[model samples]
Target: METTLTLKDVTITYDKKPALEQVSLSFPKNRITAVIGPSGCGKTTLLRAMNRMLEEEPGAAVEGQILLNGDDVQKLPPEELRRRVGLVFQTPAPFPFSIYKNMTFALRYYGVQNKERLDAVVREKLTLAGLYEEVKDRLDKSALKLSGGQQQRLCI
Candidate 1:
């Protein structure tokens, strides 16, 4: 099996305190993998480090090689890497916008301007996240109006 993501000796630290110490992992392509652990076990930290979002923290540091399809994640532009690798936050965070707007915001940012394409992408993503059937008739409503579970799915 081919691995789509590989972490070699990855260590994450916050203000010199190690959150994740010398961890190595690999995720196989096309497979659904879960990071199972109790609370405060660095599961979210490990995930944030994968896509370089950990760097946003004031004192966070990551040392090691994170490769996405054999390319160093550090070498890739942050936006481009994030476009390729997305992270759904553990807490549901929907933008203060309509569900349709939330769905198309990134697509528009990436220059997908055609109405047909935007509509199709939104439908496809919502369907994949199992949210389309529930929210299809309410896409114009505020995303914040959704239930916690529904909001999280919309975040996908």
Candidate 2:
């Protein structure tokens, strides 16, 4: 199988402490790869670094390269990289916006300005996530009103 994501000598650290050191792996296309370990073993750090979410932390720093389909993630714009690799945090933090706006926030941030296109992408992503059909009629409703499971899929 072809490689879809590759990490070469990836290291992550918080403040002056080491989290991951010299970890390298290639994830094959069309397959699920799980990073399993005990707490504080850098599993979350590895995923965050792959999607460039490590930059969100004040003291978090990354080393080495994360390649998505042969393109270096560090070279790609952060917004673009995030769009390509969506992260669902362990916690769900719903924004104070309508379901439509909540779903399209990232699309708009990535410069998707066309209303029709935005609607289409939001519906498509939500449909793929198995959330749109449940909330389709209430697209204009506040997303905070959704049930826990619904909100989870929307966040995803």
Candidate 3:
């Protein structure tokens, strides 16, 4: 069996302050795992490092290997790695646009532009995120108008 994600002796530092230290873990393809810790215990830092999102933060640095399906994700393009390992933030960060536009933005950013295909993808993702029924009739409405939970689902 292959692992879906693996972190080997991973460490992250911010402004010379250590956020994560010497952590190793493996997530098997069909299994689920959770990280439970107090605040500032590096849970988010470790998660960000796995997908290399920490690289975007100022003065943030990571050490060691983050492998996705046997390939080093650090060696892959950030955009490509992000596609395979999407992250949903703790808070909703919807775009300042309509409900339809919110999903369309992700599709367009990934170079998906066909109308029918994009619509299908949006609907599919929204349905998977459990927001389809709530916004089915108002896809043209502003995403900001939604409740916090709904907006978070839209972002998912």
Candidate 4:
């Protein structure tokens, strides 16, 4: 099987303390790979490091290489890298905006300005996340008004 992401000798530290040390992993393309561990293990850290989110954490340090399709993640722009490597948080995090706006925020930031296209993309994404039918009529309502499960689905 082909690999989609690879981590080689990757280590992560926070405030001079290590969270992950010399870890290596590869996720196969089109395959489900689970990183199972006890709570507080480096699973989240490992995932964040893959897309360079680790760099956002204060005092966090990463070493070694993280490659996506053999391309170094460090070589890619943070926005482009994040677009390719999405990480859904364990908790729901809806933006403080309408459901439609929440869905279109990234699209707009990426220069999608056509209203029809934005609507279509919002509908498509909500549908894919199984949220369209639940909140389709309330697209202009605040996303935070949705139930926790609904908000999580929207986040996904």
Candidate 5:
């Protein structure tokens, strides 16, 4: 019933060249939307700008506003903002840790220390990512042992 994300008059520039221009959109909570365009059409740029990831680039600059849950993400602390608008890249990047550890790592980083809570969250997120069934019994196995597709799904 509420908007989860909003981008208004958003623009991003790299080395004085525009990557995104005057883009505005809103994403409703629990709905799915896709961005379709030719390569280099600013789809990735627009996505990166949403969480202020564009600020990491040497020559990248962003203008206008990106709101997450009614808060301007650009005005929030980077670490806190990233937790709310996580990005999963097209390619999979499983950490060198065990399958269970991979999911637990993020939970730990967010200061989740209860064993029961960690177990529940790991299974819940893995299931939501469509990966729990495949890796459920091998929670201790190294994530890299899985096939590329499986690994990518796990990373999701």
Candidate 6:
């Protein structure tokens, strides 16, 4: 099998606390991979390190390398890298804005501004998530008002 992602002695830490240590792994292309472990076992930390999402946390640190298609992730543009290697956590954390705003705000930073296009993309994504029909009439309602499952899907 061909490897799609490669991790070489990757370690992550937060504020001097070790999250992951000296881990090496490879994920093959076209295969669904799962990283399963007990709580506090660094599963989330490993996923975050894959795309540099760890950088978002205060005092987070990463050692060694994560290579995507043989290119060091540090060499990739942060924005482009995130877009290409996205992560949606197990928990749902919606913004205080309306569902429509929450969805579009994610794309705005990527230059999606036109109302028509934004609406189309929102509808497309929400529909694919099987959440459009339930929330279609309430797109303008606060995203925080959604149910846990709904919020998780919306946040996706």
Best by TM-score: 4
C-alpha lDDT of residue 116 in model 5: 98
Which stretches of model 6 miss by more than 4 angstroms? 15-17
Residue lDDT tens for model 3, 30-143: 887788899878888888888888889999999989899999997899988988987777788898899999889866987988999989988899999998988999999999
Q: How far in Å is the alpha carbon of 25 misplaced in model 5?
A: 1.9
Q: What is the lDDT of residue 2 in candidate 4?
A: 92
For model 2, residues 55-96, the per-residue Cα lDDT tens digits are 989999999889999999989999888878877766677798
Worst 10 residues of 4 by lDDT: 85-94
Instruction: Compute each candidate's TM-score over C-alphas.
Output: 0.93, 0.82, 0.91, 0.94, 0.87, 0.88
Per-candidate Cα lDDT values, in order, are 0.93, 0.88, 0.88, 0.93, 0.88, 0.91
Shift in Å, residue 150, candidate 2: 1.4
Q: Candidate 5 regions off by >4 Å? A: none
Model 3 TM-score, 2 decimals: 0.91
Q: Write the residue-wise lDDT of candidate 6 on 45-150 in tens digits.
A: 8998888888888999999999999999999999888888988788889999999999999779778889999999999999999999999999999999999999
Off by over 4 Å in 3: none
Clashes of each: 0, 0, 0, 0, 0, 0
Once fitted onto the true fold, the runs of candidate 2 whose alpha carbons sit more than 4 angstroms away are: 107-120
Q: After superposition, how far is residue 57 of candidate 4 from its true place, in Å?
A: 2.0
**Candidate no. 5 TM-score:** 0.87
lDDT of 6 at 93: 90
**What lDDT score is found at residue 24 in candidate 4?**
86
Q: Show the colliding residue pairs in model 1.
A: none
lDDT of 5 by residue, 44-88 (tens): 888888888889999999998888999999679998998788777
Q: Write the per-residue lDDT of candidate 1 for residues 22-115, one digit (tens) a residue.
A: 8998999999999999999999999888889988889999999999999999999999898899888878999999999999998898798999
State which candidate, 1 or 5, has the greater lDDT.
Answer: 1
Winner on lDDT between 2 and 5 is: 2
In terms of lDDT, the poorest run of 10 residues in model 3 is 85-94
